[model samples]
Target: MVMIHIPTHPLVHYPGDILAWIAASLAGWWQHRAFPRETERLAQVTPPGYYVALALGGVVGAWLAGSLNTVPSGLAPSHSIAGALAGAIVGVEGWKWLHGVRGSTGGAFVLPVAVGIMVGRWGCLFAGLADQTYGVPTDLPWGVDLGDGIPRHPVEIYESLSMALFLLAYVPARLRGRAWARDHGFHAFVIVYGAQRFLWEFLKPYPKLIGPFNLFHLICGGLIAYGFVWWRNGGVRADHGAQGSALSVSQPDDEPVRNLP
Candidate 1:
């Protein structure tokens, strides 16, 4: 990897530093997009201030993950993507629990993972092969050579382009109706992405077996299977018998609070 040093003059920031900032900003935007609207109430809760808080949390979480070498050690695109994904997942979910979101709300549970991976993959592409899961050697025109007597496949671009297409498809599907959302919406994206990422892992240079089994392969297959079944079976099954009165939460307390005229 080549590191270019920038003089600390007024106008110049180091390239590495600049890339980090850009990736962080993109990560923030991507993470924010997944916030679901619960009859539009989520908008009131998740404003610019909420996002600012989340971003700061993400930054800290990512730094900690990096220091701990949470996955693998490298300044590659894959690591960047992974870092952003990990941070966003924790940050978004933690924010929801902290805010005391009772019942189900849109966006809080699943969007962060979906959107974060979708956007963070670009960072992987720009960061180059050092962070890639390159494929087996081939004479096919698109193979990349990352030294060590190896010519690998450009699986990074393949995954990115594929996800972009899928995300486009998901947008229209989400806006159609509640039946679409309840039945097959979230699971569709989850299953597809899981399958894609799992298949793409084969092209990577990392170990196929993390422990007793192939972790990437297992997760991909398992999530896809689970998502498919869940979608076909009506997604999350809420226990109506256990549910409490909604009015109690929505209504004012015994002592009346002052309201604007």
Candidate 2:
């Protein structure tokens, strides 16, 4: 069994970050083109220092989650994508609340985030065991030998594929101008992505924080809950608006539609 070795080169260590930056830029471009008005509104509502807070939160979250998975005895700690995502979400949401911003400004990020993850996972895959992003042992024909003699499930690849499929489905809806898709795109992405993560987490070898579940499982659950609640509330509001419109149409013919002089 040939075990994959961690690259000793400093430049090689940051490929994931580099790819993620590129993905972010692409996501931004797409968001600007697809939802210029919403994007502008978000800029207006975003408070000062929001980006700084998000960066700090991501660092802290990555450290905390990474530590939970594997903490070196004396060496600097590692980070986890899951931790970074959760931290970033918390940071952005906290900022939004402080600024009294309502609804999902995150809709614009869904595509970019998905694309970034799909590209970034390749970095983890190539990082070998040092990245701690590997999956459980597997005998499947498609299993990867990540420098290790043992063929593993390649969970990162699975996650990337899942997100890719989501984007495929989502892009069409956005193009078709579906009301729910336009309004609650972020919520839909979160719910779908959370479900995908929750399932894939089961295949990972991370230590369980609860019975048969790890820290990521809890985070996925929270994401799913947030998405579901927002989706349901949006639906209810739409339904009520439709009913009100119907009621207005049913008004007596004698009654004027407007009060004119």
The superposed Cα distance between candidate 1 and the true structure at residue 101, in angstroms, equals 1.6
**Candidate 2: lDDT over CA atoms?**
0.70
Residues 133-240 of candidate 2: C-alpha lDDT, one tens digit per residue: 778887777777766578788787898899899888888887786655666777888888889989989988877888999888988898899888866654222233
In the range 31-112, model 1's lDDT, one tens digit per residue, is 4554333324445445564565567655765565344432544443223333333355346546656654332232332334
TM-scores for all candidates: the values are 0.53, 0.81
Q: Cα RMSD to native, each candidate?
A: 8.9, 8.0
Q: Which stretches of candidate 2 lie over 4 Å from their true place?
A: 1-13, 72-76, 235-261
